[model samples]
Target: MPKPLPLFTGLSAFPLTPADEAGRVDTDALQALLARIIDGKANSIGLLGSTGVYAYLTREERRRAISAAVEAVSGKLPIIAGIGAIRTDAVQALARDAAEAGADALLLAPVSYTPLTEEEAYQHYATVAATTDLPLCIYNNPSTTHFSFSEDLLARLSKIGTIKAVKMPVAKDLAFAAEITSLREKAKEDFAIGYSGDWHAGSALLAGADAWFSVVGGLLPHPAAALTKAALAGNEAETARIYAMFEPLWVLFRAHGSLRVIYAAANLLGLTKARPPRPILPLPDTLLPEIEKAIAALPER
Candidate 1:
């Protein structure tokens, strides 16, 4: 039998997938990145996630990346691999591939080109959950998938035994706090809620989110962990101090989505040569100075 599922809590490092100048997966560089994440003391390592650029890779390449990551981790940190695809069958196949590659759990997004109904979305997850015994974390990223799960849909999905967690998107409004509190109350007692909006992670934690499925945390694991540790400990002074260091990076993220900013950060930090997948190329030359300045501005811990 596979290992028991890990509780969805604490910081999870989501490093951008490393690719060479030619856009091929760089296994050596990826391994180094995974080792660094473990060293930073993150609770888990999330691969093929939004930050991992899974939607851009060929199936064979994704499988190889998982194998390499599993080998590199060597059980140092639990690996939660994304298995999302537009079609249900395709998602199931990816989930199987991830399990065979030794991933501990699956992170799924209900991706669709045509709009998906709440019923369709729920069934998509229900079918996928039935296909595997491995725990699944439903990824509700409306910005990318353009399909947001309603509170009722989420409640229904949580009843699925293998559906262990949800990667929630925080609304960018003053009511964000109330939204998290209400969602947490509506979710199953045992179900874990993880927040993905990097900017909202601190507030989400304070509002009782169980985990931070973070992009910035993936690369800047030490400070990310420090921020999360502070929140969990209720140390507002420490939290504010650490969050201030990320203001420069947050500016870039707000301008361009996290993937672009993270690739720039990874390159600046010498962690990887991770250019965003084609069609989502590197931020233009005009942004290079900003990326440099943002990284340079990072406080010396």
Candidate 2:
């Protein structure tokens, strides 16, 4: 029998949306940046993910961004739209707009102001699933969402008819690899486990992650693919070499947030001159030299 397909596998490039100083979406810049990502050979495009600052934008802004992204790619790739919201009704509406805008799939995190019970979380997902037939990827980023998903919760989520994968935030080399195992035991065999710890991607992907839902991939898709390919091929030497090149940027990501660092890197690389959301400011000028040095090390191919 043929092997089953991987969950959101390959390099799912997570793009940082470009906007002007006025905080308006720069459709021209967005289009240019997306074209570069596609040219870089990503398997799919991750639009409006955490890296995109989905939480801070208004509902209408979110919709317009999706429309621009859908139009920009022109169906050249499958756009995985992040529709994470604290309210189910908002998430459902976002899901509708995503579908209408031609997104290939939806990703949601259980973003809540107040604490949520496991049942409440499950119901939120189930309710959103009912809004669209687009396959859902459960985004388990406790760092931003402030809610951690237990294995039991993952198991229940896996059973949702429309849910196909889980974007589990990981710590790179060690614990992330174990999460793939533990999550599998709790979830179904098909529930694809994707990781987003940019620092240790090589070790995690080599260890058996289904997808490298990456920030670096969006910035430098070609080199990121080279690394992921090396890891997938079990070519440890190549993977290690490429990962080392990324070490400096990863250090910055650890110090500041990847969201801010990536925006700065994008600006430095001439990809997006736009800054991140209000509270999440640009990488400090003092850090620019370091970021520039790190970016210079990224292999173009």
Candidate 3:
């Protein structure tokens, strides 16, 4: 078996932060969602991710969500809090709040209204990483953040002692193995490399990426965990078998964003009834039947 990657590896399940229309986190509903992740034995709980509506929340509300997660999991699994903001100072303060609220790690994206230069991005990470002792994962999500990390910038950020891992976007043509190898060469020794983009996560893990910072794993962890276990063990046949089960859901995720699909899934699963924060609307009622079929296809416990 391959050695397990430390701290940030494996199935880091990203749960949505259930909240009211006012952006106030519903701690009760939030805790309920976390209970599922804990029961599924996910490796970690990623609170306030993009799927969690981190960008839509106020700092007070974000802190409340982190506090609720810490209370819900009770340390059964690590909590990696997302603290991305458009300003470096805000990110620093958010990092402090996460550490104070008992988060096990931090996830930062270079969120910007004005697109940032590489040096600006590096400095932003460096500054925030300096603010707290908590280990930070660089969130390389260009699709939403509009700021991409060049390999050189990633390598530079990896050298920051507190910046321990990277949550990378899916590679083009699914070239995860080559990208992982090239990234590992320049990154500091044991600096972990993980991928997002749930549909391609099994392939990335099979190709030797350290982790799956997953969106789907949040709502459907049983099969997600199964896929992670098989792929991490280099069991390609088993991984392929389990991954095939998620095909319908992945198609929905691609057609309508994963964020919208997951919110709808959470409601259908009776996990939470919170809608996506506005200007981002819920998936149409027409899609519910397909989502139910997708959910029914997965293993139940």
Pairs of colliding residues, candidate 1: 14-218
lDDT of each residue in 221-253, candidate 3, tens digit only: 778899999999999999999989999999999
lDDT score of model 2? 0.84
Q: Candidates' TM-scores?
A: 0.93, 0.95, 0.98
Give the higher-TM-score candidate: 2 or 3: 3
Weakest lDDT window of 10 consecutive positions for candidate 2 = 1-10
Stretches off by above 4 angstroms in model 3 are: 1-5
Ranking by lDDT: 3, 2, 1
lDDT of 1 by residue, 153-214 (tens): 89899889899888988765745568767766776777778888887788777766778898
Model 1 TM-score, all chains together: 0.93
Question: How do the candidates rank by TM-score, highest first?
Answer: 3, 2, 1
Q: Cα RMSD to native, each candidate? A: 2.8, 1.8, 1.7
User: Which candidate wins on TM-score?
Assistant: 3
Off by over 4 Å in 1: 1-6, 20-23, 172-176, 299-301
* Clashes by residue pair, model 3: none
Identify the candidate with maximal lDDT: 3
Clashing pairs in 2: none
Which portions of model 2 miss their true places by more than 4 Å? 1-7, 171-173
